[model samples]
Target: MSLRKKIADSEAVLNWVARRIAGYARRVYRNTKWQRVGFEELDRLADAGEPVVVVLWHQRLVMSPFLYPLDKGRICTITSAARAGSMVGRVQHLLGMDTIAMSSHKRHVALSREVLAMTKQGVSIGIAADGPRGPERVLSTVPLIWARTTGKRVFCMTYSVKHGREASSWDRMLLPRVWGNEGVFLCKEWPHQVPRKATEEQTEELRLSLEVAMNDLTAEADRMVGRAPWEPRAK
Candidate 1:
């Protein structure tokens, strides 16, 4: 009943707050002037009618929905089966995204199968590489596995703003101003490949390399928005 409790976004009631969260996201997205990078390639790829894996750090999740070309195809993201994930699903739904709400009871293979099926059905999969929790900004190899299996190249995108409030959370999530200056959304195609037969050691190395690449890409976006880069915490 306290003001502090009421003001916080609690996982227990996050689903209930989806509308307000989505509304605020839209206001910030539309009100800010965003310099977009690498979308022309995305536009072309979308027009080609095949799906690709879109990956971003969980901290930059705020404006991702708008980056999807809704008219060209459908895209979906996975969320935990926990109540917090349910809240994310609600917000994604409100923002015109399809969500695969993962069940805690399901086996890892089962979830991977479901994701593969979605890709086969022309659904683009979006992943927060360090999501559902974090070793913050660490790239998960599972998405790379899907990219290998489904033959979808990965595109990384992230954003930063000149006017925003950075959360005190582990990933330092930035909540951009609803109205103000500028921001930048930068995207790039990851040129690395995850070979189907790659050994565990190779995959692990690739993941670490990817973590650095994505962190640099994020830094570029932050710099574009006139801010210093946030260093990677996950090694």
Candidate 2:
């Protein structure tokens, strides 16, 4: 094979191996305790037969799969173009989810359309708001835009782990130890119909509201895990 082909092949092999390891670690060492608090709030919306956009922090993806039902309708989770995201997509698929690869810079328009398509087809949309890269816990406008365009409500999902492993990466990636306490926080449905001609203040207000909703749900999860409001790591 050519040198470039050889490199690509090797990288794919490495990714497969890494995903296997992560999968094993999750099965053998990770403890996932899923608690449903106010899940009815989310369920009521889903039961309404309306499209919804789900948002969470990038680093908390580890615990997200547990927040959702294993048999829930397919969700379109946003992922990175990186190999790690490819591995994550494989894992998510194994967990019975559908995913879409996206890049903050290059795939914006394409991903936006993909999300819209999913919504129109009655699939739920999932986003790691502080994802693909991040300024941690900060909100991104992509999901907001998708919600506004599709007339979908934005629902914030937050998770906390009582026992888990942490990576030093941005978003402080987490790996819950087996039987670790996991809590899911859901916010009431919120309108995302900001007009294309919305005022600067109106846009900022919407962004601020999203941030607060995320922080609120995150805080509640931490409380469920008995952590102080100031704790940094997932444990």
Each prediction's whole-model lDDT (CA): 0.82, 0.68
- Across 1-235, the per-residue lDDT of candidate 2 in tens digits comes to 8987676558577567757755754663244445667666567655655557888878678656655543545567777767667666666666667788776566666766777788877778787887776877778776676667777767787666676666788777765666535544445455456676768788778888887787777788778887555344453
TM-score of each: 0.89, 0.80
- Top-TM-score candidate index: 1
- The collision pairs in model 2 are 29-178, 30-177, 30-178, 31-177, 31-178, 31-179, 31-180
Highest lDDT against the true fold, candidate: 1
lDDT of 1 by residue, 128-201 (tens): 89887787887777678778888898888788889887788887888888987699888888888889899989
**Among all windows of ten consecutive residues in candidate 1, which has the lowest summed lDDT?**
7-16
- The residue ranges of model 1 lying beyond 4 angstroms of the native Cα positions read 1-14, 232-235
Model 2 spans with C-alpha error above 4 angstroms = 1-31, 47-49, 104-110, 179-193, 230-235
